[model samples]
Target chain A: MPTTDADTTFRFLGCSEIQEILGKQAVDERQLAELLEEVPLDSVYYHTHSYFLRSRFIERTYPNDFAQWVAQQLQDHVLAERLSVVDPFDFQSLEALREELISLIDDHLSGMRTVPRATFGTPFYFNRSRILEVPTGIEVQTLREFRDAISDVDSSAIYFHVFEAHLRLQREENDFSAWFRGSLKLPDLADRMKALNPYLGSLERLRSNMLTMCDEQLAKSGRG
Target chain B: MIRELEQYREVAPKGTIDFLYRLSDLVQDKRFLHISAVRYGGGMVEILRRIVPIMKAMGIEARWEVIAGTQEFTDVTRRITDGLQGREETITNEMYQTYLDVNARNAKVLNLDADLVFVHDPQPAALVDHRKGGKWVWRCHLDAGLPHRPVWSLFRRHVLKYDAAVFSLPGFAQRLPIPKFLLYPSIDPLTEKNRELSRAEITQVLDQFGIARGKPILLQVASFDRFKDQIGTIRAYRMAKKHHHCQLVLAGSGVAHDPEGEAVLAEVQQAAENDPDIHILQLPPEADREINALQRGATIVVQKALKEGFGVSVSEAMWKGKPVIGGTAGGVSTQIVDEATGFIVHSVEGAAFRIRYLLSNPSVMSRMGAMAKEHVRRNFLITRHLSDYFTILKILSSE
Candidate 1:
């Protein structure tokens, strides 16, 4: 299998992810001071784990011990079978890769992944107090008012389709567990949508209406 | 008498460099600590490097620290960075574990005891777990309006713990219980990169890079990270060059932990198709002066990050009085006022059209460049940033 564009879109880095997986290293001031002395100017000493490497760098860390493991594993390992989809050299393919990734993330859900429970709450002060929590009204009595209000959001209805396809893809249990997470691209999209602010406050209305519709559906289904 | 200040109309007399005295007076009794994954890489380091010395000169107690963790720690944080910017990560259970373990180890060591602990980005966000005397402020440089849910869920766990959150723009600031303050991050004008460059030095560097700049240049100064979308930048440059005959210099350095910089740089090279005009540079990381000269020499600057944090390059270019066309994603859109400071585009064609538009009219471009610089001076500066910090510390201390 050859590498394709679908494999290499970016995933954002955050603190919680760092908390869970990064190995611990004790950094005493003395050790840092010592390394600063030994290390040449303008270069910082970086230590990386073997698993994170692209597999070839693995030998450098374990040296003699790793050569023996490679010799033992080479019988089963088919180096020729390796595939790559995330080529950095291809531009359209990169966008296509990003699209495929966005679709994958859109579909991912939290329930599918067996992640451990961690402590909750912001790392700074508690934002427990409520800001303006306005309940957007979408359950108006007549279609005329709905049409007038929704005329601004008719284009968003198209995005609603993309958003739904993304959600449905992530909802599948047997599929890639990471891709099944729900509407996960909302935060960055919300920013991209901010650039659409020249269209007035219409998008905000649509977003609020969509949230309201979801709440309404949940209430009708008695899920909320 | 006020000769030094006259050089910079952006700051008060004697330059905002002297404002360090006033800032020191304000923060005389305060302790400020910052936590990140690496101390030497990226825009965060650039800002910290200049500000720390100035803060010390002001007689303020300020320290910068990187969270101690292994390769897995960096990998997980990288994934989370991707996730938060709305990148799809096949985040596994093991990945989550990497994130937690790293944070736990860092928490045990970081002295969460300052009057204000300024948490820089999602890397060490969870160090809030270490309860000390100081209040924590998560300075989110990325756009959080659309975050990958599980990733955001992981981060929001830490975000919900802050005294207050600080963002580069209001659109990036999330709607949470804690109030969000907007502080535009700035580049040091006195830094080697932003300082005056002799025409000979600029010409020498350009000649060395094989960048013939008498022709119109459309450039994007950023790290060779995939998120910076260097390929898309090339495509736009090609399109614009078809009509405008402009060259593009995609200049940047690789970060310490970004595993994909080389791969992204290669893609950018391929996208250029061996065009002599398209210069894909992998400069030294500390080559800030070179970056400044690159921007100062350029005709137009672009930051085509498919998703961006507060793009420091956009501010840097605007500060250099260069017209810019930025991506319509994250903080780029906020910086480029679109048709005023510069055009904000969503696609290659859009960027191309804007590039052509700017090239077609030099007077318009000049006006836009001037406006862009004023926009940066008024909004993005160390003085403005420090003031935001001063107010936040006062509020936190009161509480």
Candidate 2:
């Protein structure tokens, strides 16, 4: 997934999969055609997954037509019903709708046995060992849990963790791969994780991808 | 000490001195402690030196203490000072921690117990957070209308802890949960900087500096700070000189607590190069008598500061009976009444026009000078300042 410009005018898509779906093929054919007819392709993505796009999508496609299509064509009845209840005109903010959609996708993906976790471009792997060791009382399963865990960590601790990881990595070419291998002690996982560039992913997308990878790895190990 | 203030009756109105006496009678024997960043240099110190002595005279047991800090602490505070004066600057978390650490250390060693404790400026503002049973008033001496956001947010956290906050002008204050008072800073008319100077004494001081009596002088007396806009003063002087043949004198000195003074002084020097008529004199810290002579010898005094905190120099010049063209920045506008006491200008061009107009009409200048002197006498004298403090003290004690 490509990152949007960091300017405040550009709204970052919380989920990279959602961004990819929006960019490549609209989830609903009729809704996509109707939207394309009403707004220019460039304006539809004023700045990828912008508030304008979210508002327009909610206003033009929600409830009757797009929700039905999502239920029938996309086979996401739960998400379709959720979208049906959200009144775009009366909604509090664009972020509320975006979060609702992202959460729905996150819930659906975590339910699957196999998950692809690619954040920005980096890959993350999780197993039963990591999930059971979270300091927080909450169980680690979905993207939201991963994000919450990261947020729960103190800023100084995060700084030191990243610093220590980077320092050990410096002995061998000073890259994320080396750090993951040397500091995190995940030699087999280093090369795959190193491929991802955090600058190319929104913060939300990166965390979500990491969570998905953790879940998949745990499932593969038969300990999830 | 109270008898010494009686000498002011010869220069001030009878009601002013009597008011001080009455207020002092009400607050007699009350203990007050003033905490500031430095003991010498700057207007806060200058005012405290005179005011503390007189407060003691009035039967108020007043004491003054200076906070200790390292050079790094002073550097951080200098940036904060500039930020409060509407300059764009970044104050980091490290800087904030250092400032609080210094204040906390001082709080540990200093005796803060009194009927009232006055914490002057941002340097010692955090002392209120560590106060031990006293009415703490945060005396902010800078323009606080639009401080740089980060710096103001940090300062506001500590300032909100005070019982009350004091500002030089009503506009220089921030909206706070606590009660605030507008108290204008004053110049000591009896100090060496504002006392009567003999004709021979003034002439000799000017001659020592090689400032010839040939040209009419345009003077600015302030520290070489960016907010003071000494460069802007020079620019206005240059523009005025195109119309009038008057020479400009920029005389100022720096304080030890402010780290940016030397850089600003160097900038002023670079801007003043190649101008023979422009005199940039970096006076010593103790050049109060010389500053008095310079202001007394000037045809017109200008304080074209970009942002000011009740510029005492404006009051100092007005007290000497000189027509002042002051910047419409902070409390300077409060002292300078456009076309009445003195003219308030917003830009260099506006200041130049006023400077030229004042020099062209000597009678108008003389009349304005008289008005300026009367204005200072009525409002900006140390006696009035002392009386205001007494009034606040009375209210605080009653509460």
Q: How displaced is residue B232 in candidate 1, in Å?
A: 4.2
Q: For candidate 2, lDDT tens digit of each residue in A57-77?
A: 012223333344455345556
lDDT of 2 by residue, B1-399 (tens): 367788787777434565456557778888888999999877778889888988887789899999999998999999998888777888888998899999999999999998889989889888888888869888888878778887788778899988888777656767788767657788888889899999999999999888879899999988888889989888888888888888888898854566688889888889988688888888888898999999999999998887666777898999999999987666776677567777867688989899989888999999989878877886678876786677677667667
Best candidate according to TM-score: 2
Candidates 1 onward: DockQ, in order: 0.01, 0.01
lDDT tens per residue, model 1, A1-224: 01011442212110000001011111221222233233321111011111111111111212111111222222111111111121211222223433432233223312234311111201111111111111122222222332333333222222222221122122212111122122222333233332222111222343454455434434554654
Residue B337, candidate 1: alpha-carbon lDDT: 61
> Best candidate, DockQ-wise?
1
In model 2 chain B, which range of ten residues has the least summed lDDT? Answer: B13-22
Please compute and give the TM-score of the first chain of candidate 2 against the native first chain: 0.25
Error of model 1, residue B109, in angstroms = 4.1
